[model samples]
Each structure stands twice: as structure tokens, then as C-alpha cells.
Target: MSQQPPAQQQSHPGETGQMQPRPRDEMADYTGRDLLADKKALVSGGDSGIGRAVCAAFAKEGADVAIGYLSEDSDAEHTAELVRRQNRRSLQIRGDVADEQHCHDMVDKTVREFGRIDVLVVHAATQEPVSDFTELSTEQLRRTYEVNVFGAFWTVRAAAPHLAPDASIVITGSVNGLRGNKTLIDYATSKAAVHNLTYSLAQHYMQDGIRVNCVAPGPVWTPLIPSTLGEEKVEGFGEQAPMGRAADPDEIAPSYVFFASNRLSSYYTGEVLAPTGGEIQAG
Candidate 1:
């Protein structure tokens, strides 16, 4: 567990280097058991934070990772380097997830690099807090849904044909979706839709021997927090959780590894795993 982050903020789409008490997003001490040996994966939002950690962990597990990002060229390059250091191939595909065409392009590019995609991690998302529900703008609402909801739908739809049997699709959901948030109204709603999407897609893809699951994390120490939340909220970030601290990217990544590895989670489908720092909630 990590201590609470200091009061800090960054411009949108924050960078890892600019963060104080730099996040443990590299999975440096983790050792892979080849659970994903030779598998090919495409991760949206693979540039920083949980996405970066997932890419690193996937590499260690012997998967060639294709990273998809918006801009953050430097961070994406660094993540690709981490995957390459594992002696696995890494491809960086940069674009905005909010665009339907870009979502399809991400899959096409990944398939081109790796021949086929065995795992698809839908992780790109954006959120902005609003002081009052009435103050939420239509633009923010649309942006939130476009990236978090529509992007997930479009990317998975495009990758469906390329995915082979026994493929795994993991979606990133949020604790806010399970229990709504006051400030993050639209973001929470978008995530709720994503959670439902997981269930629907799981059923839709089961006939093809594919598995779909979700990881709805609680407050985690990632670039998203400092970039979107106010400084006052950042200071005590995860204090509300029973753990009294935010999780490092390293901590939350094993959940993805578990879901991705057929050896571990073959029977699991349409499941939601909440790594919420001991914050218990009913289904």
C-alpha cells in the first residue's frame, strides 16, 4: 500500500515524471510464470499508471503487448521499452479512443504487428469532477460517454473478428460505478454502462470460447487522480477507504494478470472483480 499523495495537480492527460512521489507503475519486483507465454495483447491507455503497469506485467508473463494511447509519446515509448526489455515485442499505437475510426484502427494496427490478438484490455477512460450536478456541461457528458462507454464498445467490436477462440477481454470499471459519486456523476454513469457492457459481451462472446471480465478499482494512486481531482481531494485521496491509503499501480495489476491467464480464470466470465482497498459492497 502507498501513503496518500501530496496536494498536487497536473495538466490533463498527466505524465508520470511530473507526479510527486512517483507512482510504482512499473511492476519492478514481479516475476512472471509464463502464464501468457507467446500470447498477443492490445491495451488501450497503455501509456501510464495502471495501463503502464498492466503492460509491464503482461510482458513479464510472456505476452507481446501493443500499447494504444492518445498522445503521451514519451510515456508510451517508455512502456514499450519495458515490454521489449522482457524480450517480448511491443508496438505503440497512438490516437484518441473517443474516435470510432481510431478505435478500429487500434485493433487493425495490433493485428498487423502481432498476426492476431489473444487479449484485449479496454482501459482508456477520462473523468472530470463537477461541483454541482446542475453544472455538468453537455460537452463533458458526451466526452465522458464517448471515451469510457462508446470507445469500449467500438474497440471490442472491431477486435471481435481478429480474436481467436479462448481470447480474454478485460474492461476497466470503477468503484464509483457500483456506488455512485457526487462529484463524478457522468463518469460514474459511464462506468456503470461499461460494467453492464462486460456482462452483455461476456454472454455474446461465450460461444466463441472467449471470456470477458472487469476490474472496478477503488481510489488508486495514478495520474488520473492528480490530473482530474482538486488538490484538496488529492491530499487525502484514498483515506475514505478502509485501507486508509491508495493502492499503487503494482498492487492492482495482479488482478488483470489473473483474469488474463486462462490457466487461472478459465471458468470465470461476466465477473466483476473490485479491488477497492477493503471497501466492501453488495452486488
Candidate 2:
């Protein structure tokens, strides 16, 4: 993929088909080695972007997947088709992850379809940029936390009972969570909470033989960029990174794959694999 310039989308939660230059989110060229053979997985926000890539990768790795999305029926259907093409069962569930009941229902539905969950990828997130801290409203902050932080909590809690031994849970974090972004105060804060949640859950679940980890990515060219950052910011979206370009979802999905496959990451737990395009940060 080539470098992308500033692009704008009129809607929040932008459609993948409308993205210019298109995000490399389908993982079309990725080949799997059956690392997750016969596993059952659940991916939140699996309709597009990182979630879509992860679902495809998991399917290619031989895991049947259940995808949870807010709406985006077309995207969801398309993703399901992609999984089916890989010869894996794909279940699509639609609802707001911020709703605790919806989270429980999603887990129940997945269990009903797949019998058990061997991997859980909590990848659904929402963000709205604020130029200054003062411009961030109470409602906006609440919504951000609800979707980015609380949603992960609800889904994990609801799925905990049904998770098989050695199950892997991967949460999506952000570079902004590690280093504050001036324009994304609320979103950064919410993701920071998710980062800590991953650590805490790792410790709490270790006794159950479940491993929890996080992938904190730098700027990635996903729908969230144009829909949230608007035209000016989107043009130079990832120039600040050492790579000078936002990562494709294709570039990030492998981290989830590594974490999901116990064969690959059995000894890893409570770790945040930061794929920030060489933007170094202090621990």
C-alpha cells in the first residue's frame, strides 16, 4: 500500500468500502499454519479494520469465529464470507458492546454456536478527537470509557465462565494510551484504562490457565482515522512515527495471532506488545 493523504469521511464508524486507497485489512496475502486449528474464537468489532483482519487471520489459522459488531450488516456479512471461504464457521452478532447485557448475550450466543471460546479478542473501540481538554464534554468522556474500557470489562467477565483452559484474551490498546495525545485526551485515557485492565486480568486469570495480553499499536490506517481525525489530520496521519506512515491492519493482526495461539505465546502473559513503528517509550 502507498502513503495515504488526508481523507475525510462524513460519518462516524466509516464504511470500509468507502475508504480511499483502501486499508489492507482483509489479510488476503497472509498464510496460516493451523496454529489455531479447531479453536473457537470471539472477536469484538470484527466487521472491519483490525477486527476484520484478525478474524480472517484466525479463520486461516483454522479457528471458527464469532464476530460482534455494532451494526454494519454489509461489512459483517462480508467478513463472515471471508471466514467461510477459509472453511471455518463464522457467527455474526450485532449490538453495542457498551451495554453489559449485550456483552453477556454475545458470549452466550457464541457459546451456543461454538460450544467454547478458546480465544477472545476485545477489539471494539470508539473515539472522538477534542482539540483541548476543555472541549471534551462529560458525555463524550463517559461514552469513550463505556465503549473502550467498560466494554472490554463486560465482555471478558461474561466470557470468563465459558473460556477453556489456556484460553487467550487479547485487548487492543493504543500508543496514545502509553503516551498522551493532546487532541485525544478522552480516548487516550480510556485506552490507558484498558492497558491496566489487561495487566490486572492477566494476574487474575493466570490461576485458571488463561493468559491475557494487549497490543498497543501506533497510528494505523483504519476507518477510525478519517472518521475521527477529519481531513487535515488524516492526510499526515502517521508521519510522526519513525516509519512515517500509519500501519495497515495487516501489519497489526499478527500480534493478535501471536498472542492468540498458545503454541506461539504460551509463556507470555500480562505483556503489552507495542507495535508503534519504532516510536520508543520508557517503561
Candidate 3:
């Protein structure tokens, strides 16, 4: 593997605040009506990007939040600061989702802090170079799977027992999962597995009063773009999309909001909400 220093420094897992063009995290113009009033949410990868937007949405909807992230303390603090602006309680847990034990600790800590869990959002993922297939080393593949698949699995496993009846679990999938990313084979494959896992879990847990669903986003301009892609690629991202722009994290976040609130989508489960800005294909 060759190391070429990124044009804009990397925010490893990802962040919205530091993105080259800065993703719109807040739905500044959107008004809220307390959709998730008094609800409790536990979100993974909640430090920034779509996860950060979702955190803000949860807070705006009147839900206190417990967030988990992978070693991004500053980013996590920034998210918590934003959550607090909405007047909701926020707890930031720093740890790696790839570790099963860490996942357990996150859930346990959330319950200990918040007393119960009403919604669980798995929004963490990993993707390498979208055009460098042959360069994906075995270690890279393992790391990708560990974060994207194994991490999600451990999250659900740990949170299952703590999930309240009628609780919803939203896992973040990607358009790449639906339409394979040749540049991100391992990452894409893991997301595909997440989609299937969401479906299977929904059906398997339907009778248990748990709803497992997925949200697949396309072309959202999060910090990952500037970090993972070369400088040139980041310059004109949204231009290639049919919507003529990379999605703002705020735009993609409402899907999670819809899936999280049982009142809005009580009858929906095991399904996916694709927020791809008119992208015909999904992942």
C-alpha cells in the first residue's frame, strides 16, 4: 500500500464539520413538531456526518441521545454541543464499534445513563478507494468488514435485550450496497450484508416488538469524501449526481427520522428508505 498524504487531512472514520465543502448538518429551514417526544435514542457513529444530523433530529424531536463513535473525541464533543443546543441530554462514548466487547459496553452505558433504549441507529461504516480494487489488502478487507458488518451485528446483539417493546433499529446502508462499488468491493459487500441482515432481523424480531430497518444514502457529501477521495475528486462531487449535487447530511437524515418514529411509520419494517437524490440505482 502506498501512502499519499491526503490533500485535506483525513478525519478517519468521517466528519461533516471538516468536510471540504462542509455538509449541511442542520435542517435550518425545517420546523419540528415533536415526533419523537420523550423517546430515547442510541446512535452509533453519531459524532458527525449523517449520524450527526440524525442526532440533531433526534434532539429536535424531543429525544435524549446516547452516541457512540470510534476515537473521535473532538468530533464527538462537537456533536454533543449541537445536541445540547436542542436542549436534549447527550452522552458521548468513545470506542471502536469493531470490538464486540466495546459494543456491549456502549449499549450498557447508554442504558445505565438513560435508563432505557427506544431506538438504536447503526450508522457507522467503512469504505476504501472506490477505484482501487486490486490494492485492497487482506488487512484492509478485514478492517472494513469488522467495522461495517461485525460492528453492526454486535450492536444489535447487545441492544436487543435492552430494546423496549415497539422499539425501532435503523441501520445505515448505502447506494453502493445496492449498486456495487467496484472501488469499494469489501465495503460494498458488507453493506449488502447489512441490508440482508436488516431484512432478516426485521422478520425474526417482528414478534418480539422490535423493528429493524435500513436507510441507504447516495452521494451525501460527508467528510469521508474529502478524506477518502483525492483532492480533485472532492472538488466537484455533486455535479455527477442526477440531483446535480452531493446530498447534504440533513437531506439524508430525515429517512432515519422517519424510520425511527413509530408514530410515522408504524406499519413499516424490514424495509429500506433510500435517500439518493433521484439516483435510479440503490445500494
104, model 2: CA deviation in Å?
A: 0.5
Query: What is the C-alpha local distance difference test score of each model?
Result: 0.95, 0.92, 0.84
Q: Per-residue lDDT tens digits of candidate 1, residues 1-283?
A: 5556789999888889988778899999999999999999999999999999999999999999999998999999999999999999999999999999999999999999999999999999999999999999999999999999999999999999999799999999999999999999999999999999999999998898999999999988888888998999988788899989888899999999999999999999999999999999896
Off by over 4 Å in 1: none
Candidate 3 at residue 126, lDDT? 70
lDDT of 3 at 39: 88
Which candidate number would show the highest lDDT if scored against the true structure? Answer: 1
Candidate 3: stretches off by over 4 Å: 1-11, 14-17, 130-132
lDDT (Cα, tens digit) per residue for candidate 2, span 164-205:
998999999999999988989998888899999999999999
CA error at residue 38 for candidate 2, angstroms: 0.5
Q: What's the TM-score of each model vs. the native?
A: 0.99, 0.98, 0.93
| Per-residue alpha-carbon lDDT of candidate 3 for residues 64-121, written as tens digits (9 for 90 to 100) | 9998988778878888987788899999999999898999999999999988899999
Q: Which ten residues in a row have the lowest lDDT in candidate 3?
A: 1-10
Pairs in steric clash, model 2: 5-235, 6-235
Top candidate, metric TM-score: 1
Could you tell which candidate, 1 or 2, scores higher by lDDT?
1
